[model samples]
Structures are given as structure tokens and as C-alpha cells.
Target: MAGGVAAGLVAGALWGLVFVAPRMVTGFSSVDLTAGRFLSYGAVSVLMLLWAARGPRRVPTGSQALAAIGMSVLGFTGYYLLLVLAIRDAGTEVPTLIIGTIPIWVMLLGKPEHLLWRSLVPGLLLTAAGLGLMMASPHAGTTAAGSPNYWRGIVLVLLALACWTAFAILNAAWMKKHRDVNATEWANWLGVATGLGALVLWLVAGSPARELAAQPQLPLFATLAVATGFGSAWLATILWNVASRRLSASLCGQLIVSETLFALVYSFAWDGQWPTPAQWAACVLFTLGILASIRAHR
Candidate 1:
């Protein structure tokens, strides 16, 4: 359990770093950057899958094959699109606020009633308060710190969370169905599938023309995209899954907050965008609310 929590924290930290990398990759629209990432990841993932599978394996059922395709689209295609857009437009601070939304998402999806309209009142209130802080935070608009597409950034982050949450739900079911496979093997192959789907999605969205026209970010964005699509997406998933197996679901849930914490600290320390007192207060209140909600769930 301790190992799992520790692994989760490590994964979260890496993801936080990757989340900030997209903004550094110049010229690519968020979509373009994402397209570049998927293209690279598809290549890398296939190689890894080949190495893992050792040339030949038994064929999958029609249903299982379909599940892989569906998972690829839902988990990779949807989530990466939203995540790239959010990071590109929002800078880094605004997305920190969105990370606070995950616990509520997990809880609302069939958490025990005792933690809801009954015994868990304090938690419910705290969660609500945290959400209020997030929504009320001055960073929620289209003019965030001089950025042009501020509101779009906010919406993009929320959409990322929605895609990710749905992915998690489906993933749990997928794991149960494929319990016979080693967890690592399942993850590696699914990553291969997801990368392929992302590539198809990218080409269909007109990446080649965009890449030719928007050339300022080719080398830089390609680096970030590879780091993000391959390392963050694949490696992080592998680590998080290992950790999730060891940790309690609730603890696993709370550790996600660590990513926002890491991102904010890095952004503040490096970018010199010192969080205002209001932002600090909001962050503290948000943490308290999450703690309250977690306790309530228990």
C-alpha cells in the first residue's frame, strides 16, 4: 500500500512536468501538438508491444478487439485532445484548479450514500466549497494572465477531466474482463492500440497540412509531444496501475491532488507567477474540502 501511494506520487509528479511541457513547444496549435504526440507514440508503442509479445500471440475475440478500439478512442483520443488544448491555452495555473475536480468526480459516481445526503454532510459541504473556490477563482475566464483564449483553456481542462474520468470507469471494467493477462502486458498492448487510434484521429484531422504551415514548433513540439504521448501517457499509466493495485481506492484518489500541488509550486518558483493571497487561500480551502470529503467517504 505504501509502495502504491509512493508510486502514484511519482507518476503524478512526472505527469505534472509533462503537462507544463506543451506550452514550451511553440507554433503548434494544441491540436497540432497533440497530433504530433500521437504520431510518435504510435510508433514507440508498437515497438514496445512487439518486444513484449515476442512476435506471435493468440488472436483476440471480436468483442475483445472492439473493446480495445473503443478504449483507445475514449482513453487516448478524447483525453489527449482536451489535455493538449487546456495546457496550451491556459498556461499552467488554471489547470491546477481543474485537478481539484477529480475527487468529486470519483465520489459522485456511485459513492456510498452515507457519504452523501446522510452522514457525510461535512464532506459534501467541503467538496462543494472546494468546487466553489475553483469556479470562483479569478483564473476562470478568457483573459487569464494576458492569455487570449482563457475561457477556452478552462473548458478544455474540464473536458480533459471528463474524458479521463470516463476512461477510468471503462478501464476498471476492461481490467476485470482481461484479468487473465498480466497487468503490465495488458497495459503495453492497450497503449499500442491507443496510439494507433490517436494517429488515425490526427491524420483525419489534417495534421500534415498544419505541420507544414505551422513550422515554428516542429522540433520543440515534437520533443514535448514524444515526452508527453510516450512517457507521460504510457509510463505513467504503467506506474499508476501498479500503484493502484497496491493502494486503497480512496488514497489513490487523493494522491491526484499531488499533481496540482507540484505544478503550482513549479510554476510559481520558476515562472515567478507568485500566487496571490486569494489564490493561496483558495488552494488551502480546496485541500481542506477534499480531505473532508475523503473522510466522509470513509
Candidate 2:
């Protein structure tokens, strides 16, 4: 369990950096990024799938498989699409802020938090205030319908958060109940499905295979995509599986909020563009709000 907690933290930190990737990788279309990531994940999954198939296979059955699969779609594919959309439409800050609210979203969605009853409103109010404060960036202060792109990105980010929370919860359940049904295999199947979906989308969008293919050596880009999607994600889930075994679901949920802190620090280091003091203050407030929200639930 200790090992699992450590792994989970590593996974969480790795995930925190993902928000930076879409902003970094150049010369790739949005579809390219999605396709590259899933395709690589699918390739790796196939290898693992075949290896496991040749051995003692502990694949999931009816309900477990269904739930795991649902999680993959929501957590993996849906999250990626929304993330891509958010990144494309708005810059990183907006999407990052939306993602910052994920713990709150998950907590609110759970309904029966194990918190001190009176603290719920205070926790929630503080967190929401912090989020609002973050939104008040001097440059980004007004979220008018004026910039469809920015608002669109914001909406997608929120959708992504909701989807990610659902995925995380279900994944925890799956890992808890069906210990034998390997999450990697589950992820493999999901990646395959996502790759296929991307393929179809690619064809529909008139992006020729020739386009991705002609780029002499897109293998690195595609491989990185795969690693981030399948590799890192699989590792993260494994860590999550371990962590959940040790921690309460709610506690684990709270710990997960720390990813935002990781993201903020890393983002600043990765990109020299720091938000104004107001933005930083808002982020700090939101972090406190999240802590308060978790306390209320406890």
C-alpha cells in the first residue's frame, strides 16, 4: 500500500505535466495529437494484451468490463478530446483553472461527503470564490460570449473535469472489486477503441494517412503520444489502484487535488509567462478552498 501511494503520487505529478504537452508539441494538428497518442497507446496495449493472453489471463467479465470500458472512454478518450479542444480554443490558463476545480466537482457529485455538516457551504463558497478570482485575470477578466473560442475552451475544460471525475471514481471501484481484471488490459482495450475512433475521425475530416505518414519520422511524436496516453495513464491508474487500497475514497480524492499545485509550479517553470499577482492569489485561494471543501466532507 505504501508502494502504491508513492506510485500514485508519481503518477499524479506526471499527469500534472500533461497540460503542458499540447502547448509544446508543434507541427501536429489537433487530430494528429489525438491520433498519435491513442495509436501509440494502442500499439503498446496490443503488445501487453498479447503477452498477458499467452499467460495467466485475468481479464474482466460482464459488469467489470463494462464499467472499466466506460471509464476508458470517459477518462481517456473524452478527456483527451475536451483537453485538445480547450487547449486549441483558449490558452492553458483557462483550462488549467477549470481542471483545478476537479476535486470540488467530484466531491459535489458524490453527494454524501464525510465532512462536518456546517463546513460544506463555507468550503464550497471559498472554493468557488477562488475560482472566480482566478477568472478575474486583468487580461482574461471578462468572460464574455464575445470570444467564442475562449468560452468554448472553458466549457470543454469543465466537461473534461466532470468526465475525468467520473472515470476516476469508476476506476477506483473497478480496481477495488475486480483485483484480477488487470487495469492495463482494460486500458489497452480502451486505447484500441480510441485509436479506431480517431482513425474514423481522421478519415471523416479528410486528413489523409499520407499527411501523418509523409512526415518522414513522426514516430517520436506518435510514440510520445502513446506514452502519455497509454504509458503514463496506465502507470497512473496502477498507482491510483494502489493508493485507493490504502486511503479512503474521499481522502484519495482530496490528495488528487494536489495535482493542481504541481501543475501551477511546473507550468511556471516550463513557461516563463507567469500570471499576474491577482491570478496567483486566485490560485492560492482556490487551493485553500479545495482544502476546506475536503475538510468539510471529512
Best by lDDT: 2
Clashes of 2: 5
- Taking all chains together, the TM-score of candidate 1 against the true structure is 0.78
How displaced is residue 229 in candidate 1, in Å? 2.4
Steric clash pairs (candidate 2): 114-297, 114-298, 115-296, 115-297, 115-298
Q: What is candidate 2's lDDT per residue for 139-206, written digit by digit as tens?
A: 44232334668777878888888888887676666666765555465566665566566566556652
True-structure Cα RMSD, model 2: 3.8
Candidate 1 Cα misplacement greater than 4 A, ranges: 55-60, 87-91, 110-149, 209-216, 246-251, 277-298
lDDT of 1: 0.64
Q: Least accurate stretch of 10 residues (summed lDDT) in model 2?
A: 138-147
For residues 142-249, write the lDDT of model 1, one tens digit per residue.
235567777787888888888776665566556645666555665566676776776666667745775555687567766777887777677777777765555444
In candidate 2, stretches whose alpha carbon ends up further than 4 angstroms from where it belongs are 1-5, 111-133, 139-148, 182-200, 203-206, 215-220, 275-298
